[model samples]
Target: MTSTPRSPHLPLPAAALLLAVLLTACGNQPAVPDWQANAHGAAERATAADLAGNDRVARQEWARARAEVARTGRPELLARVELMRCAVRLASLEGGDCPAFAPLRQDATAQEQAYADYLGGRLAPEQAALLPAAQRAAATGAVAASAMAEMADPLSRLVAAGAAVQAGRATPAVLALASDTAAAQGWSRPLRAWLRLRAEQARAAGDAPLAAQLERQIAIVETAGQPAR
Candidate 1:
């Protein structure tokens, strides 16, 4: 028989080492979860589609957000939803065809007043003194006039009232009353911001013919004497 050609053979230890290296390489390779990765990719695609003016996709995103809010049952998230809804309504008003959101406006105003009252009662007399004179008078009147007013602190009451005003439930007269009181009591930056935002929202919602109208109203409020409630 012809001499058998010897097959090349590695030492056992070397072979084992090579096998371990191959196994390690395979183990180190990143494993992709195809379903999860695909889902993420699809989400990115959906976002892109939404940005490309796809109303359907945009609505789907909104719906998802709404569902999340519902599932979480967070009041802050609910408030955001309400705000977004209001914004959508305002934006839909093309050529002045938008429906009046009177009820929603009223609700907002109520909420603002409640917040103002709560804040007002919590403030110190010295702090209250920084508020506008008219506002002080209004707060006094609110304190004296309210029969069921269990609100002990003037500043807290004022804050709650301010919150109502900011919510758009309060008329300009009421807002000015609350604002004057807060200002005289030593208006905080937060209170001022609240008033400004309320005025801006009123203008944005087209409550008046133009933003100028809202500005004029605010100016009048800032300068004019307090009205009798």
Candidate 2:
């Protein structure tokens, strides 16, 4: 007599029980990590402060946010926080310390490195003053051009606009882009004020045309939020 072959499948009930066990197990997974939550929370607070015209508080919050993730030992998150800090510093007319980001640069991706280069270039007059003058100028010019063309971050864009003005690369197109951004983003108040001050200084130094152009750009940006007629 031939022996009966055993069925290769589990009974329907057993299959259903297995699935339920899996579903329950997945439902009980761990919550989000503390570092991630803290970092996000800090960033939101910083953004809110920036929008409220509180520059110092915004920068402080941004720095705190970066520190939150720095404790996690995650390079990508750390790089992102560094970039945010750099953006805040740049927008405030203080620029950031280039050397402060050297550690982040080590593990950064190509895009992140580009951002660092741009910030360094933008702050070249102060941060990179020790470099040979010719080398500094070349690097600054190259990074400025690349950043203006490639940067997508809104805060970074504002910073780039201010940098362009400072470097005498303030073409109409550049000014137009900066003006439009400043008008569209209410958080740009501090940046706009800084640009106005820069323009005034230029005027006092006898660059009347440059000053007038910058002032026009500032006027356009400052009036950008007016109610429609």
Candidate 3:
């Protein structure tokens, strides 16, 4: 086969050079670290298992995620992984200090320290600016718990609800919003948790009927996946 002659201005390597330039332009996004990518995916799975209330599975997944992130030997990154786990657990109402991040705290950034405080329900309004975008408004108390219904991401809204609950700011409207978000996401475990709190709130408010209704809802969510008799 007769090959087309190369133009003097465009040598054989010119096509390859052009391809590299075009590829570079198309790949403007920075390359993600392999371990970071793997760790991120594992972290997501861990949070999912947590929301499903599968503690054992969540633990296993979190370990995998931590292992991946630990490859960097970076304490700040490790601390972030710990914080992510703690945040999910907090949202699930499984109260516990982020002990894992403590030793790493010295290496954590100012923003991370602020996040740790926020997760512990101690963040001040001024520190709210350091929190994740999803929780900022809630942290600042600029937005009512009722306004949680307006948050777009289900998981983010749930996390914000946890912050509100920790801060003793979870109102009836907040409970309702959290319950709805959990139910919509089919996160029955969190749904039950939020409903239980709502029931407690109802009883405290002397609304026995409302409390009873919430109790029934909890039961339904609990038995949703059981084998039929």
State every prediction's TM-score relative to the real structure.
0.23, 0.54, 0.83
Give per-residue CA lDDT, model 2, range 114-220, as digits (tens).
55655545443444443223223433543344345454445555566555554556555554455455556665565476567658667778999989887887676
Residue pairs clashing, model 2 = none
- Descending-lDDT candidate ranking: 3, 2, 1
- Which wins on TM-score, candidate 1 or candidate 2? 2
**Who wins the TM-score comparison?**
3
* Superposed model 3: Cα runs more than 4 Å off: 1-31
Model 1 has an lDDT value of 0.36
Backbone clashes for every candidate come to 55, 0, 0
Poorest 10 consecutive residues by lDDT, candidate 2: 12-21
Off by over 4 Å in 1: 1-154, 162-171, 205-229
lDDT of each: 0.36, 0.54, 0.71
lDDT-superior candidate, 1 or 3: 3
The digit string of per-residue lDDT tens for model 3 on 1-229 reads 2223222221111122110111121144655557756675677677778888888988898899889878878887677778777777776676636788899999987777787777777787677777655567677754476566666677667777787778777777777888888899999778988999989989998999999999999988888879878
